[model samples]
Structures are given as structure tokens and as C-alpha cells.
Target: MSVTSRTRFVNPRLGTYFGIFVSSLLGLLMLLLIFEELGTAEPLLRWAMLLGPIILYAAIGLSAPTREPIEFFAAGRRVPAGYTGLGIGVAAMGATGIVAITGVFFLIGYDALCLMIGGLAGFVIMTVMLAPFFRKFGSFTVPSYLGRRFESRPVRLLAAGLMAVPALLMLAAELRVGAAAGGWLTGEGQGVVILLMVATFVVTAVLGGMRSLTWAGSAEAIAAVLALLVPVTIVAVMVTNFPLPQLTNGPLLRALMHSEAAQGLPIIDAPALQFALPGEGMAHIAKRFTAPFGAIGPMAFVVTILTVLTGVAASPWLIPRVTMTPGVYETRKSLGWATVYFGLIMLTCAAVAVYMRDFVMDIVKAGVPSSLPEWMQRLVDLGFVAIDSAAPLNYLSFAFDRDSVLLSLPVAAGLPAVFLYFAAAGIVAAALVGVSATASAIGNVIAEDVVNGFSWEPLPRDGRLHVARIAMAGIAVAGGAVALVAPTDPLRLLLWSLALAGSTFFPVLVLSIWWKRMNDFGAIAGMASGFAVAVLTILAGEANILGIDGALASILGLPAGTLGAVLASIATPQPSRSVLELVREIRIPGGEVIYDREMRLLRLKSRERSS
Candidate 1:
């Protein structure tokens, strides 16, 4: 073979090989550490494991030049579709999702399945209604698309600010989970571990930027899937040997049912296993499976779905993958593979939840510590101790409540090295994805809204890249700070993010894209109203917002914002002729060609015309 052929065959990119090698070594080291510290590794091992991916990503970022920061931030618009799809999946599977499902399972027995079905339904809605639209618009940020469609600079700025708040909150919650995990693994002060984790994430994210983040995220997704599979598969086999129905019909189930039935309810109905029912069985499931919806749930779920939809629709993180390929068909093909990969991971998470719920009571009976802290002891009284016995690893359960225990599973599994590797990967992915969105939004704000409106000196690519880097660094710091200050409840933080997104951006984005009559006045009114309602709901302790709970809040919040926008649109005068014309341009398919051409012409105009 020729030299070029051999180089291609060998996969000459040193970074790719180096990443794999380092990850393997780190995994091995963590395994060794786990064995050494067995029963007592809690937080120490967790913190140490976080180092590997950080170093790996930082090395990648520092080795590359800073001039093409957009490429670094957005993968040079050249990411493979498979990677982008996987990246999206991984980002979605943050610490909160893992912890929440596990906690829910421990509390509700098998009835939590309904909630999972609900979530899957939401995802289906996203894929069918929202994904194609996003794929078509092809913008770098959600706000940018809004700016173009509505011809309103203020609206775009408001969207950016709204998106940033929730993103930061979610990021903070994830970091807190990691920190708590570290505390469990090491048996140390949570504050110290949290601080270290925060610092590490901020430093690594600031240094590595987006290019490094993409590669790291892909690897993390693979590793997490594998780790989750091992335990879930083991539990699946175990469950097959002791099926849920059989167990429920045995002595333990009968005893509980008999005792509780005297209170006017039966505890062991066949259908109750599949869905929620009334009486003692129902009460038990309700206590464990349901959350307080109030106003928070509806607001949160709606906002989350909208935020994710917007992010996926306009994020530069995915844009690079589409641009890397030569055709849309290839992009779609990659997306299909990505979806499959993501689905499998999500399935593993659900299975793990089921397994944990099946055995949680037994674990708690066996693992509850007499010497636990007062708060932890109360948790035990409240049935939180069950989680310790549910899973093979029970350290977090023995030490904390169900909520905290769930957050600490990555550490509890005696797989700190594995978790650390996963965390490092997750952090990089989140930072890169978040920063890319932020940078693109900022770029659009400046290039199209700010600079264009004022006719000031347009920023060059190099300058734009510089600004993006600075913005990214700031974002990392902000995210870290929020992580430090926020409540340790991952679910709560997630709800907050989702509610904010739904109330502020979801309604406006959907309307702007599909409704031609959606003038700037209507868009602004809708967003502002949504924001106010969500904030008030959260403040009033109605975190779940609706009867469907936190998981469904995002979907429910859509109408509140949409209504506000529609009513305002009708109340306000129609948009100016120029604004209506702008919407027409945006509605056109392959609108990106116009944007690309405009950018090129602007660049050319700035340079000398001489041949």
C-alpha cells in the first residue's frame, strides 16, 4: 500500500489512539483501587477517578490552535452523524436521570414503570414533531433561529438568557451528584469533594473546549452503556429466576397484603403490578412512585422538553456532525444509528430501576446502620434504607437517604474508576455542548442582531472565535458556582431547568417557526408570561406544577406559554412588512444556503476587490 493508504489504515490520529489507551489504563487503575478499598471507598475513589478524562481532554485542547475556536467549540462543523446522535443521548443521560430512576424504583416497587412509559412517550413526541424541524432549520443556536424568524433582536436575547439559566441549574445539579458520590466513596466531607470536582470540571472544560469534548463524550457514552449493562443484565437474570409475580404471591407479599387489607385496601393485585390502583397497594405505590406535582411538575416538564428540543434543534454541537458529512442522507443514516445506541442505554437505565425496586426492602433490612446520623436514621424510618439491600452495593444506602443513595450509585458500585471515567467524559460532553450553544447564540446576537442593527464594524471569524472562548470560560465558572450553591436534589434541579425552558422559549420557538402571524410583540409577551408563571410556581413550592408530576411538567407547561403568546399576538398589531418577509425567508427549506452565502459575501466585501 502507498504511504497515504497505510496512514489511513493505521488511523494516524494520535489523539484517538491516545484517548483509548488512557481510558483503559484509568479503568484498570480504578478497578485495582476498588478492590483495595472495598466496603469503604465511598468518596475518595470517586474524586480520583474524575482526573483521567479531564487530563485527556485538556491535553487535546491545549495541543490545538486557538484561531478556529468555532471548530473547537462546534467540532469544526465536521462531526460524524453517529457521534452527534450518541453525544445527544449521553448528554441527556446525566446524573439526575440515573439517580432519579433508581430512587423511584426503590420507593414504588414496580409501579414506576408507568412513569418510564410516560417519559418514552415524550421522547417519541420529540423525535416525530420536533427533530425534523430542527434538522431542517440548521442554525447554530435556538435563539438565532428565533431572531431570524421573528426579526426581533430583543426576543433572541431574552431566549438566550432564559436558556442559560436552566442550563446552568442542570449543570449545577449534575456536579452536586458527582460530589456526593465522591463523599460516599471516600467517607469524607462533601464540601471538599464537591469543591474539587467543581474546580476540576471548570478547568478541564475551559481548557479542552468543544473538539476535545466531542471525542470524550463518545467514549464516555460507550463506557457508561457497558457498565450499566453489566449490572442490569445480572439483575435481569436474577429477576428471571425470581419473577415479580411469583414473589408477590409468596409469604412476604401475602403478609403485607393481609395486614394492609384490614385498613380497607388490598396490597397484591395482579394488574397493580403494571399500573397504579386504589387501596393499600395503591397507597404504597403512590407514596413511592408519585411526586408532588403542584405547579412545578407541569412547568418543569414542559420547559425541559422545549429546552431540549430547542437545544437539539439549533445547537452547534450537532451542527458540526451534519456539516462533516457531504449529504443530508448520510446525516440521517448517522442519526438512525445514534438513536439506536441511545435507546439501548435508556433501556438499560429502566431495567436497572426495576431491578433495584425488586430488592430494595431486603437491602435496607440488612444494611441499615445503628450508628447512622440523625437525618439518615429518619430516612431509614421512612423506607430509604431499602435501597442499600436492593443493589449489590449498599454503602450509600447504609449512610444516606434514598435520594442521596440514588445519587451515589456510580460510586456505590465499587467501580470508582469506571464512574470517574464516565464523569470526566460526561463533564466534557456537557461543557462542550453547553458552550457551543452559548457561543453560537452569542455569535448570532452579535453578527445578525447587534452589529447588523447598528451597522457597526462586523467581527471577523478570528475575533468571533476569541469572543466564544471567553464566553465558554465564563460559562464554565458560572456552571461550577451554581453547582456549589444549588440544592442536592438532582430531580429538583432538572425540574427547574425544564420548567424555565418550557415557559420561556418553547412556546415562542414553536410559534415563530410554524405561525406566520407570530409577531415580535406576541413572542415577547408569551416568553415573559411563561417565565413569570414558572418562577411563581417554583417559588410557591409547586415544583411539579401539575398532577402528572415533574416528569410531565415540561409537556404541560407548553400550553401556558403558548397561550400567553397567542393571546398577546392577537392583542398586538401584526408585525411590520419587513418582519413578515423575514419569516418567509426562514420558512423556506435549505434556508442555510442563504445564510452561508450572506456570510461569504460579507467576508468578501470586507477584503480587497482587486484580482
Candidate 2:
């Protein structure tokens, strides 16, 4: 546990670095705001906000090159719990989680809480059931762990293949988000900006791998959180004379309820928590801020939350983060920190939704059609919101695209242009962290578990590093193409990705760690069946061809995977004695990683053979 000369802990000046970064960022933003006040050309300011932070991120990436495998693959396993936790939180939220969730809350009111609740539950499961054990096992990737556990290269390769889709989907979603933010800021097309974003992801990921991502991601976390909080706080202070948006939103909720009632939107005596589809009977009329389940049904709510929980718990990218920490104890503490930061993020999101709803309701009550707010016009020009008609504007007349609403919120709040620019930078930061993290995971998995697993001989150190960098760039390119071609919103793409993750990895991961009876046959059968079911059901759900929907895909996918794994294990021979012993060792705490030791021995044997 003690720090030694050989240990590669993060620089102790990390705090100092972060402190300086934040100050410079905010100072630059304020300068831009003053320029606006002094009547500088608007186009120049827009371009600066769009490109400034990206430049900073690239600079960080350029500084992160490393020749060592451990440094590139695992950040040298010396990241403190707090920093690791921040990285986890940022990676989990990405641009989709932070932006889409808030926008969904704005659109659906209380029903959006399900996503937050499910994610928090997933973190708890990770802390209690998964992360500590993974840290003890010390694999570079999830597929690496599975390969080692089953002692089968085929199992490892299959896992790498199965996991690639979810990772790519997530990468696509993040790229789309960053592209949208950049498009909005620069008045450019998404296709063009997405290409730019892809290059940025590749540069950052290929240079330092996890070592760069871990540290830069921590910095992005700080910027994203501050960007989310500052505008919301300013808006809160203006309306309620309170700076704490998380706590002072009660009055706004009451105001929203009154506005809905006065607009004759309909009111019902049904319990606020009752489940009802959008515009359904009693619950349908329950559009008040405290009301729940109005936007989605009971089944949909349950499925959505469960899908998110399982997806997050077994996220391919997030799980490997446990290995970046110092030990099992630090892994546990890191997850705990992730929970705290994630909760703060979701709470702040809710506050954004409430304040946003309050603003729209006031406009509706004003009953001004021709004099619609300049902010709404800005949104319309930007294509984020559209007015339904030339008649008096009501809440229903304004349609907000959920994927882009977080970027629009500053406009909706009548904040100065600089605030809008600052929000854009924050979204860019969120999307970058997500892009780098997912690309890193996919690249490492492809190189280590798939390519290396297929090799007749282990690759040399330098060869491995080169392959990894090339793999990362290639993955980034594929992800960018998907982002450009897919018509789905970032949220929908994100949900599908989560459903796939939950279906394929969640069951096998849990069983492999906790069930000694699990073998290669079970692992293969479970992954194949679960993945097949998830894809078919997700497509069917998207097409409405069957009773299934995307939200419920995992409801069937997870059970299918679990059943396949359990049944296949029962029908097959038991695992060998060595594999069983490895399982037992992973369960215990405070020991060297068995996988690391085996890898070293295997390398020594290879060297002897070559000589």
C-alpha cells in the first residue's frame, strides 16, 4: 500500500494543474463575455468557444506519450481513489447522460428520475459485487478477465467480438453529441464537426492510452460540472434569490403547477406517483413537477431502470477503470466516490429541468404569440425547438429536441451569449471524455484479447504499442462513420448500447465471478444466446414488429443469457482444478493478481523457446 520509487502514482501537482486549468478557462470565458459587452463581432467569439477547449484537450493528449505498456494500458495502477472516481463518473455520464437525461427530465418531468435511479443502483452493485474482485484479478480489459477465468482463448476472442458493438455504439453516441454541440456553436453541419471530433478522440487516445484519458478525464469532469452549475446558479439567483439550485427549486415547482392549472391543462386527483402513458387519464393530466410516470408506463419505467442498472454495472469501459486504482480497497472507495459525484450530477440535472420548465410556463402564461421570446427564436434558428403555429404560444406549441435541449437551455433562460458559449464548451468536454474512454477500451480489447489472442507468438512490447495506437484510430474512424449515418438521437443510441451491454456481459460477468461452476461452454453459450436475443429484440422493438420494445429488450435478454449460462454449465463438464483455484484466489483480498503472475510466467516461457 505504500508508495515506492517504482510505483507510478499521478503527479502530486495534479490539483495545482486542475486549479490553474479551471482558472484560465473561466478567465477566458469572462473575457469573451466582456468582448460581447463591448460589441465585438459575434462570429469570432463563437469560433473561439467552439475550438478553445478542444485545443487544450489536444495539448494534454500531446503531452501524454508513454513507451511503457503498464503506463499505457492501466495508468500505472497508481491513480488515487478520488481521481479514479471522478473519471468513472465522467465516463458514465458522457455527453449523453449529462445532456440527454436533463433534456428528458425537461420533456417528461418526474419520469426521467428512473434513469438516474437505475444508474445509482448500478453503481451500488459495482461497488458491492464487481469492482473489487476485478481489481484483485488485474486484467487490462473485461475480455481479458473472462479469457483468464475460463482459460480459453476462444472464449476471450468471442467476448472481444461481442463487446465491440456496445463499445462502438457508445462511441457513436458520444461523437454525435459532441458534433451537435460543435455544430451549434460554429454554425456548421454535424457531419463535418463529427469528423473533427473523431480526429480529436484519436489523437488523445492513441498518444497516452489510459494514462492520458485518466488524467485528462479528471480535468474534463471538473469543467463539465462547473459549466453545468454556473448558469443554473445564475438563473436560480435571478428568480428565487437563491444560489443553490438543488435545494431551492421548490418554489419553481409550485409555480409550474399553478401555471399548468391556470392554462387549463387539466388536473386529476390520481396519486402523483401513479403510472400513466403520456396524456393518459388521471395520470396523463398529472403534469405537475412532482408527478411521475406521465411520460412512460409502469412496464417501460421498470425496464428502462433495469436496463440502465445492468448496463452501467457491467459497462465494458467503466469496469476496467477499477484496475487503474491502487488496490481492492481503493477500488471500493473509488466506486463510492463515483456514486457521490454521479448523484450530484443527476441532482443538478433535475434542477436544470425544473428551472427550464418554470421559464417555459411563464412564457405560456404571458400568451404572447407574435412577441415570442428572443431566446425561443434563437432556439428555432438553431433547430433545437420549433414553434407549432403562428397562434398564441403554449407549452405544447414548443417542441424541444431532447438531444439538443441542454445546449438550448442557456438560450431558454435568456442568459447572455457568453453563457451559451460556455455551455457549448462544457458539452464538448463531456463528449471528449466519453469518446476517449470508449475508444481506449475498444482499442485495447481488440489489440490484446482479439488480435494478440490469435497470434502464434506473443507480440514484442513495441509492436503491441503500435498495434494498440492503430487500433484506437481505426475504432475512432468507425465510430465517426456510425455517428454520421445513424438517424437516431444520442439518447436512443445510448439506450440500445446499454441494452446490449446488459444482455451480453452482465450475466456472464456476475456468474463467472460468483459461480465456480461456470465454464467455457457456459460462457460461450450465454454470450451467443444473450447477444442474439438482444439484437433481434432491439430491432424488433425499433420496428414494432413484435411485442418487444428497446426498453424491454434487456428484460428478456438478461434472463436469456443467465438461463443459457446456467443450463450450459449444468450440461458440461466442470472446470479444471487450476481454474477453480484461480476463482477462489480472486475472491480473497490483499494479494498479487493471479493473471499478472501467469502472464509473466507465460512470457518467460516464450522467451526461453525463442532463445
Q: Against the true structure, whose TM-score is highest?
A: 2
Worst 10-residue stretch by lDDT in candidate 1?
273-282
Task: Provide the TM-score for each candidate, comma-separated.
Answer: 0.70, 0.94
Give the local distance difference test score of model 1.
0.49
**On residues 63-130, what C-alpha lDDT tens digit does candidate 2 reach at each position?**
88888888899988888889899878878858888888877777777878888998899999999888
Off by over 4 Å in 2: 1-8, 266-286, 388-393, 455-458
Q: What is candidate 1's lDDT per residue for 506-595, written digit by digit as tens?
A: 567667767878887888788777777666656544443333333233443556678889998998888788777655664554435433
The residue-level lDDT of candidate 2 at 604 comes to 89
Choose the strongest candidate by lDDT. 2
